[model samples]
Target: MNVKSINILMIDDDAINLKLTEVMLKKHANVNEIIKASNGLDALGVLDKRGDIDLILLDIVMPVMNGLEFLSNVYSKNSNFNIPIVVLTTDETVKKEAMSRGANGFIAKPIAEQALIQEISKLIDLG
Candidate 1:
């Protein structure tokens, strides 16, 4: 499948981290759109409009509506999205929690571009 067809939603509160992630992924990874949301509530809004997203780059902790909370809402309401989710974080504890919440895969923050792509590749099979 063409990478350009997949849409990516990145949910995080930090501007610098979001910029870095966008910069890193833009280098080679092609996608239809790369949407950024500062919090889970904002992300849910995006997800509502675009339910065909192929992947989500989720951060476990945030000020308004954390990733886990987002996942729960997604699972409960967004029946259309059986989308692959890659939890991005620096915390190991949050990783465990995110996994339990239904993340397809995960990679640590200080986001490594290749590692992110690798995780996405694994989940893209479903996409």
Candidate 2:
């Protein structure tokens, strides 16, 4: 498949995870840009300012606002909002809840590069 570079909004409270994810994406995916947000609230702000976000990688646990809360807010604000959101978390228990809340996909944390890419490809036309 033909690869298309995309802009990703990554929302995680951990600085280390953000950096590591960025590095992994840069190395493995055709990423045009990677926007980082430390929390869901900040991610919302980023979304407000940018319209080109192709995908969202969100953590379940965060300060200010959690991934589930963010999903609620985003879907509540605009039912037609189409950006694909993939919930990234270590807690597998929240998988069903997150998916029901509007998450298009779910990935267990310590995100594998291949899995991440596959999930993105499934939600987006990367070819």
Candidate 3:
């Protein structure tokens, strides 16, 4: 899969998680660009500046606004935009709800290198 032109948006509250995920994405996906946001509210700000984001790796728990709220807001704000969002979380209980809300996929916490790339590839049809 040639994802050289794909830009990814990564939303998480933890700085460590953000940096680690960025490293993994750089190593595995070779993505065009990875935009990092500390929370969903900040993520919305990022979206305002960049409209070409192809995918979003989002965390469910965050300050200001959570993943589900972000999803709902983004959808409501711009109903025409259809970027794929992959939820990153530790809890298994929210899987159904997350999907129902608008997540294209899910990645468990303590993210795996292979799984991350695989999910992104599948969602964007990288292969």
Report clashes for each candidate as comma-separated counts: 0, 0, 0
TM-score of 2: 0.95
Candidate 2 residue 10 Cα shift, in angstroms, is 0.1
Off by more than 4 A, model 3:
1-3
**Best prediction by lDDT:** 2
| Highest TM-score model number | 2
RMSD of each: 2.2, 1.3, 1.6
**TM-scores, one per candidate:** 0.88, 0.95, 0.92
Cα lDDT of candidate 3 equals: 0.89
Encode model 1's per-residue lDDT on 1-127: one tens digit a residue.
6434677899999999998988877775456678999999999899878867778999888998988999888888856558888898888778777888788898987877789878877877524
Error of 2 at 126 (Å): 1.0
For model 2, residues 13-86, the per-residue Cα lDDT tens digits are: 99999998898889855789999998889998999899999999999899999999999999888889999999
Error of 3 at 76 (Å): 1.1
Better of 2 and 3 by TM-score: 2
* Model 3 lDDT, residue 81, Cα: 64
When 1 and 3 are scored with lDDT, the better candidate is 3
Give per-residue CA lDDT, model 3, range 15-88, as digits (tens): 98899889988875458898999889999999999878999999998999999899888888988869999999
Q: What overall lDDT goes with each candidate model? A: 0.83, 0.92, 0.89
